[model samples]
Target chain A: MTALIDIKDVSHTFATDGGPLHVLDHLNISIEEGGFTAVVGPSGCGKSTLTRLVSGLMKPDEGEVWLHGERVKGPRSTVGMAFQNPVLLEWRTILDNVILPLEIVPNKLSRAERVDRAEFLLGLVGLTGFEDKKPSELSGGMRQRASLCRALVHKPEVLILDEPFGALDAFTREDLWQTMHKVKSEEPFTGLLITHDLRESIFLADQVVVMSGRPAHAQYIMDVPSTGERVIDDLYTPDSAERLNILRHQIQIAQGREPADVEAAQ
Target chain B: MSLKKIAIPTIAVIIFLLLWELLVWANGWPNFVMASPSDLGPAYVRYWDLFLINGWQTLWRTVAGLALAIVFGTALGMIMGFSKVMRDALYPLLVGFNAIPKATVVPIIALMFVGAHDFNTVLIAFMISFFPIAVSVSIGLSTLEPEYRDILRSLGASKMTIFWKIALPKTLPEFFGALKVAVTLAFIGTNLMEIVSPHGRGLGALFDSGRTNSDYPLMFAVLIALAFLGIVLYYVVVVLEKIFAGWAERQET
Candidate 1:
């Protein structure tokens, strides 16, 4: 079967006041249906830009993005997005905010059905009773949970998480990582996560793609050895440490702190 | 609002009136030159009928002009917000027009549509007031967080959908803030036309008549009436803002 998302040698350049700034250079990545992939790179390696490309929010200057073997010319309702800031509308109750995507996307579901859908997701995220509360009433973690439900409420084909848990504290972040696993098992969707935390990548994703510095491409791709269901304690295993070390070394090479030969010698 | 909030301003106004009465008494200024707060009381009772008729005229004209400003300003603002080309084209012209003293244009408007006093008064109010609303609304639209927009766009939302679902609500706080200011400007605009193009209507015309007869107490009474109307209108906006955009306000709880 064709990959659910196929980015074909995408290249992009942004015009700045100083002149043209190259961001992505001949980058290629693909995610199979129901697969989760995490992208980790330097601060400005155009990882966020990659999410925009897959979602079709913006077109790559050179390459074509294909979804289910079709070129993405513009944004698709099949794609759902979540960011670090949940950005729930203050005017809306948590339930209403979660239902926002359903309102925007074309749907046959009645209002009652829509509420049922959002309520289910919110329950999965442990936000059961806070549906009537405003966004400000919830803690940061709770708000992000509502944001995740909003993304999934429409049962999107692809869910783009642009550092969705980046702003949370360590404990909350880990809790969310497990919640992510639970959410995916309940609502299967192709997931593309853009993150900076290395531990987060191995914990949540079956595959991690390390990207090089600016004008980045996928420098190294690692298949996380599946050990059935994942838990936070699983990250402490000796096997998981070795994998983390390898990925860390690769990132050093990508960052130009260590020569590529240093890894080859080891 | 708390009772303390209302009581504080009320007490301050009473103190202010007492000081004014004391000043008039000490100075022993002629009644024709300066009227004390006590003098204003009798003047109000004497001209109570005239105040009702003229005050109603000014009140309606101000409300009508502000209503027009809100409609026209919101449309213009949405256009400027959505299109960069239109914003660039219209902004400079709007700024220039707004800069022209509205008082100077009152007579020109009066001359252009001779005897259309009500229209001229309403137009001046709209002209003076709409700029802030348009400018505030455009600012609100332009500064929208890109992440919120991207969330919608990825869902294949149209521009209109994004505007209604996201942009319009986000712009409410700014819109209401601009409305508060524009209401005051609308009052000033109506009064300007009434005073300059006096056509036997509004408190402004009454004030002018008091000046002609050298009835200082009557002039002060009219001034007090204008201030009262402005306050009532301003509080109406504040109450409406509380009802509509209450979420924008920071809650103590």
Candidate 2:
């Protein structure tokens, strides 16, 4: 099947104070129509550069990025993006913040329907009473949850989570993974997550694509074993543990910090 | 909101007033030489008409000049902040203009306007007091987080949309801060022009006369009136800050 999103033989260079920085070289990645794919890589591997390319915020110097069979040249309207920081507008109330996309992008829904959708999405994430609250009024995790609702409110064809849970506390992170899956099951959009955490990739992604160091490329690919519907308890299984372990070792080697590095440090 | 806010300043002013009264009394200085705090009342009654007319003139001039400054300053700031070329071209000019000693610039302004004293005064005020506000508003627009723009862009927001929804709303707190500062500078600009101009008719003129005649009560009285005007205008900006900038404050402060 033709992929919904495709990055084929893409290379990008950034000019910095030091010199030309070649961050991604001849990288290839693609996602099926409704797949949730996670990209895990070492720091400075140009993961964010990859995101910018896919989102059409920046064009790759070589090759091309195609979305739904069309080349992406500018910011795409049919995509939702969230970063590590919630990036909520402090001046706007929670409901206003969640519905901010609707305020900008052209929509066919009535104003009331827009508000209702925003309210319903907020409710889906257990934020029923925070409709009038400002982004600042919410806690960090709650703010991220609101951000998640915002990304989904317009019901885009794709959702990009660039380490969306990286900064949250461990418990909050774990809780949000469950929230992530729950939301995904209900709202089945293609998702692309860029993360450093191997377990997070294993838990949340249908397919995990790994990248090597700067001038990055797809170095490895792994699939989570088929489960009819994933639950929090399924994460406790030994098979999942094995997957996690192998993924960890793969990442360590790609990062050039293998068991030998650990032994030498010891 | 706290005893420190209201009580400390009041107590300090009272203490300063008492000390001034004691000094005048201790030296047995004449009212022309030095006036006691109590002398302000009768002296005010003596020049109440002059006070009202001149104070009104000064107050209105200050407001008019400041209002014009705000409009021009905000626009300039938004432009400079958004465009690197404009900023690079104008920033140095602005920095130089701001440094040129507005006190000296007033005479040249008076010369340019020739007979239009009021225009000259207002122009002086606008020129002197607009930098902080312009710099403030533009900085606010320019310094927005990269992610904020990216999120908006991903939603297919145009450059104008990002500006209207993000840049403008984000500048409120900084804009208000600049207004508060500009109000005080407005007073300075107006009064300085008034001081040097021969046809001085404002409290600044009264100050010039009091200085010439060494009329201590008259100088103190004009200062009191100017202080009242300054407080009122400053508070107007503060109230505006609360109304318009409350969201920004609640967001971060």
Per-candidate Cα lDDT values, in order, are 0.93, 0.88
Off by over 4 Å in 2: A226-229, A263-266, B1-16, B27-33, B250-253
Q: Tens digits of per-residue lDDT for model 1 on B1-253?
A: 6999989999999999999999999999887878899999899899999999999999999999999999999999999988889999999999999999998999899999999999999999999999999999998998899998998989888999899989999999999999989988999999999999999999999999998999999999998899899899999989998888888888786
- Docking quality (DockQ) for each candidate: 0.81, 0.83
- Model 2 Cα displacement at A2 (Å)? 3.3
The docking category that best describes candidate 1 is high
RMSD of each candidate? 2.4, 2.3
A157, model 2: CA deviation in Å? 0.4
The candidate scoring highest on DockQ is 2
Deviation in angstroms for A173 in model 1?
1.3
Cα displacement (Å) at residue A130, model 1: 0.4
- For candidate 1, list the clashing residue pairs, or say none: none
What are the per-residue Cα lDDT tens digits for candidate 2 across B1-253? Answer: 6988989988988999899999999999988877788889887898889999999989999999999999999999999989989989999999999999988887788788899988888888899899999999889988989999999998789999999998888888999998989999999998988898846688999888888987788888888888889999998898888887787764445
Candidate 2 lDDT over A1-266, as tens digits, reads 67999999998899999999998989999998888899998899999988888888899999999999999999878899999999998888999899999988898988899999999889888899999998878888999999999999989899999999999998899889988888988888898999988878888888999998788888888988646357677778898898887777777877888767866887
